[model samples]
Target: MNRRDVLAAGLLLPAILGADTGQERSTFRIGLTPVFLDDQVEFLKRWRQYLERRLEAPVQFVQRASYREVTELVLHGELDVAWLCGYPYALNADRLRLLAVPLVEGRPLYRSYILVWDEDLTSRSLTDLEGRIFAFSDPLSNSGHLFPQYVLSMLDLRPEEFFRRTFFTWSHRHVVEAVAVGLAQAGAVDGFVWEMLNRLHPEITRRTRVIERSPEFAFPPLVTSIHLAPDRYALLARVFLGMHADAQGRDLLTELGLSGFAKGDRSDYDEILFMAEELQRA
Candidate 1:
């Protein structure tokens, strides 16, 4: 599996949310979830290039359609690294390695917003969408699907058993746009992505309002192939965790709107693993 296969494969799955890192290889190819259009993705390529210069290696930014594809890339060794959501990380933890991740507003967590069209009739709880069409950012998204579904299960309601229909928007911005455009009655989106989108395209995202927010979640983290050497993995992690203190690295963080990078561990994804397992058994 290479870059082409990664993008060719549709990736609609549950994913954990949170973070990025400075992990690198001599000639690394990495993937980012296709939440951004091409132009916005090009803007992110600069971050990979900056890390390349510091690591003294060439880095290729692989364009991928889904977090599941990114996870598959790492697992298959087609991609040396990835910045994937948390649920996907848990799903493929056996084939991946954690490098480093972002710390936002001094924490390593991110949030998910349960959203609805401004024109939607009164409803305050998750169950309000029951028997109605619902949209999720991606199948692998934490709050978007995994946690939200997990919440529904906690309430003795399953999405497939409750909602009339459920669709995957594939991107956080799409979740906002879908609900706003009335393509979906309601959905879950990354809280940070919602803020970013609203800031970037106010008229569009503003048409929708957040009806609820899930408990705080860890943002996507930079993960690598399980095959990567421990020394290289440690070096990669160090470069990222130290980014906030370095001039060029700090600039990259500023561009991504992240405060800095931080150390992370497997404990970071325990809940993701738990929910995934719970869902499978049900």
Candidate 2:
């Protein structure tokens, strides 16, 4: 029930161990990909350590090399709980169930923005990005691709037709750097990631200006297998929602740049689903 209990259950380690531990030990593996690894690894490791103790299972935090690898990890039943981007969740909604959502500054919403390399520019809107060398975080990224592309499609434009070149930087920090370093004219990236990068690595974010803000959307999601037992899933949900109320748990939440965790449901992802369907029909 407490975070210290989670750590004792071994939930903080990697998912490299066999299924014997996961099944027999009453534990499951959870993780996000490498995008937040640099800033949030400590928090993830600590959360895993805490959950292992609580569930009395050997808990592990799986490290994914890329977004595609992360999706496969969930599809193959290797990851029990994944903090994932919206686009992947939208496509795999049939296989995953929403669990909890991280709140940034007390809101469970995040946004994406078109960022240019000038702070004083008054006309760097999304329309201005046309025919420009644009960078995205990844094909599967929610803020970096899906949502932004969705917006573009709404305006009767396609990425390939709208941009002279498009590149997937694979990380929000990289997107910031790409525009700042003049490698790309503009990019769409997670607002939270941009803020975190700016705070932790200002030299990169300072050079980029937010030219446009996309509609607010749900933040990264925490989900589990559709096959997971409902009772245990409910328990998992309760534990996460109550986490930030604890001492050490609060510290870990801060480490992850979260105000707290809140109970969420599939309904919160409906917008992403609509976007995916539109993209598919296009």
Candidate 3:
């Protein structure tokens, strides 16, 4: 199946398998975006089973198209928890509790990448693509949207005036696709996502080259609604934090190209908050 088919199947899987069977169990809902999980149908199934087994409750994975949608759901109590970009989490920190952050290369940090077609070796910076089409993953994306915007603000170049045209693919993977297929001359994407795709789908990534890298920022995190029951919240946190210690969890982390999950603090996203504030005042 293609990416769209896989995503559609993933969206419906929760409802089909999470049906009530007259058991006195409450479903624990977790929201996800297609940013990294666009084609991870099997992984989602396995991860859900793993969480359900550990949490000793029904677990449901709710997939959405963008970070803003998932963030809204979590903030409104439609989701118990969500693995979200640091941008949205920082924006709504008061309404959400930091549950965990994924560890990449043993640290809960990642960067943003500015990319162009691989053969375009002449371009060295964002300024080089000043008059070309650009793809942004999502408006609420720190790496894909905010970072690029911040860079432009520093240069005193507004996106509308700098780029010939700009668009949102809504998925980091698609941003890579846009650049690869010439839909976009350049794009801003999550460095971690780009690396993961390089490992899992090199054919696509090989067509693109990383022209620039931003300073490291805290990796995206799993967050819970502040109103979640304390006991349930603790269980969710324990399962994620202990993933590295368990054999199965360790295997899952390996597949995801992550070291494990860490008990991250709200302060971990201070840099992102600063960027957001600076952009707001610009």
Could you tell me every candidate's TM-score relative to the true structure? 0.85, 0.85, 0.91
lDDT of 3 by residue, 166-196 (tens): 9999999999999999899999999999999
RMSD of 3: 9.4
C-alpha lDDT score of every prediction, in listed order = 0.79, 0.81, 0.93
Q: What is the lDDT of residue 48 in candidate 3?
A: 91
For 105-193, candidate 2 gives per-residue lDDT tens digits of: 89999998789987537546888777789999988888898877888888989999999999988888788889998899889898888
Candidate 3 stretches with Cα past 4 Å from truth are 1-25
Q: Which order, best to worst by TM-score?
A: 3, 1, 2
Model 1, which residues run further than 4 Å from truth? 1-25, 36-38
Candidate 1 TM-score to native: 0.85
Report how far off residue 93 is in candidate 2 (Å).
1.7
Candidate 1, residues 227-249, lDDT tens digits: the string is 98777677677777888888888
Better of 1 and 2 by lDDT: 2
Best prediction by lDDT: 3
